[model samples]
Target: MKKFIKKIVLFLSPCFLILCLIVVADPFKVWFNYDDYNSAVTQNGEHVRFKLFNNNKDKYHFDSFIFGSSRSHAYKTQEWKKHLKDSASPFLFCASSEGIYGILNKLKYLDNLNNPIKNVLLVLDEHCMRGNSNKKGHLYISTPALSNESSLEFYKTFVVASLNV
Candidate 1:
């Protein structure tokens, strides 16, 4: 009986650890947060397209969006504001390895907003369509919601990925 219990504990250890990481890391920006995700862990926060949006979407009012891979990062919000001469701000949703999925998701998300999307600049490269599967895209900048998956499924996929790592 003791040996069986020991084996059970061993099997559960990794599961517990992964759960802790998910809660503490809070990549989805929905778990373990109180008043606000008002905070985040920087260890893996660099891939923050989702986090940045989640943490500040309600606060920032943007009429323009610059979407693409790393190339889009060069367009500062100020530059866009200056060029367009608009009162509404611009938000750049760029990452090192963004693809069609991420771009489409952000666009859809912006489209559903109450305010109108004034301008959109999408910069693409040969590698944008290099892959057929959305799951294979960059993990840091992707979200399940963009792919039409439910939030619960996203959490499940995240947990599974945690185990793989």
Candidate 2:
């Protein structure tokens, strides 16, 4: 029995060590606080944008938003702001591959937060209308705060993704 238990421990030790490393290293940046997120690794733009808005909302007092997918990046915030009222504080709230579901959820999130939504520029195309569901993969997944998903499940998704390759 002692020998059998020793073998089991040896077999499981590497798995335990890997998990520990995953928690400590946080290759996906999901487990730790970061000042500037590294752009080399394709991150979930939805999550990153949401976190950025939440962190600086009070200071910026952003009341206007431009929501869309990567294509919308061409719409400069300065140009968009020119169309809005003088008091509008505009923010670019875009995602990597945004769909209608993401856009609606982001709108709902802002409404729930009691933030004023004075102006909105939605740069939409056929792609944005094609999907109304949450995207898969760590880089495309919706943020928990926007999707109302379990935070544990969100973190688990990132952890599992980091282990896949």
Candidate 3:
């Protein structure tokens, strides 16, 4: 039994170590405390699917935003730019199964960016209104840190989701 326990520990220790390392390193910048990360930690590794608008808000000087689920992906940004004939470049912030709460969270993050939001294209679906707003067990990938909620439940959700990732 002693030998068996030792072998199991030896095998599992490395995996535990790697898990901790991932939590700290956070390559995708989706989970963990990014505040500890310095400029040396590459911001370019962010998962762009749901985070594009938040990650690159300053890069495009975007005045317009498109927020919705995966269905909204078909609406090309350039098409809207041509239709509006405005200087504001469109940024599509969409993800699979994105709901109303997720869209609201994105808008909140955009507002926090402190840039003027002149135009918004919101493509929504029927499911958005039926469920609880804000979150549904890591269904969407947007950062909870953006919400500025510091309660245990908030931390629990993020940490649990991060650990799952």
In model 1, state the lDDT of residue 150: 57
RMSD in Å for model 1: 4.7
> lDDT for model 1, on a 0 to 1 scale?
0.63
lDDT of 3 by residue, 1-165 (tens): 999999999999988897677657665455533333344432321124435555565687878878777778789999888877567788886755667767776677767768778888988889756524554344443454444454455435545665665
Q: In model 3, where is the ten-residue run with the lowest total lDDT? A: 41-50
Per-residue lDDT tens digits of candidate 1, residues 50-83? Answer: 5566556678766777888777777787877888
Q: Residue 68: error of model 1 in Å?
A: 0.4
Q: After superposition, how far is residue 112 of candidate 1 from its true place, in Å?
A: 2.3
Instruction: Give the TM-score of each candidate.
Output: 0.67, 0.85, 0.63
Which number leads on lDDT?
Answer: 2
> In candidate 2, which residue pairs get closer than 3 Å at backbone N, Cα or C atoms, i.e. clash?
none
Tens-place lDDT digits, model 2, residues 1-165: 999999999999998898889879777666666768775666777777787788789999999999999888899989988888888899889887899999999999899989999888999998899758878788878888888877887887888887885
Clashes of each: 0, 0, 0
Question: Which has the greatest TM-score?
Answer: 2
Question: Could you tell me the lDDT of residue 155 within candidate 1?
Answer: 62
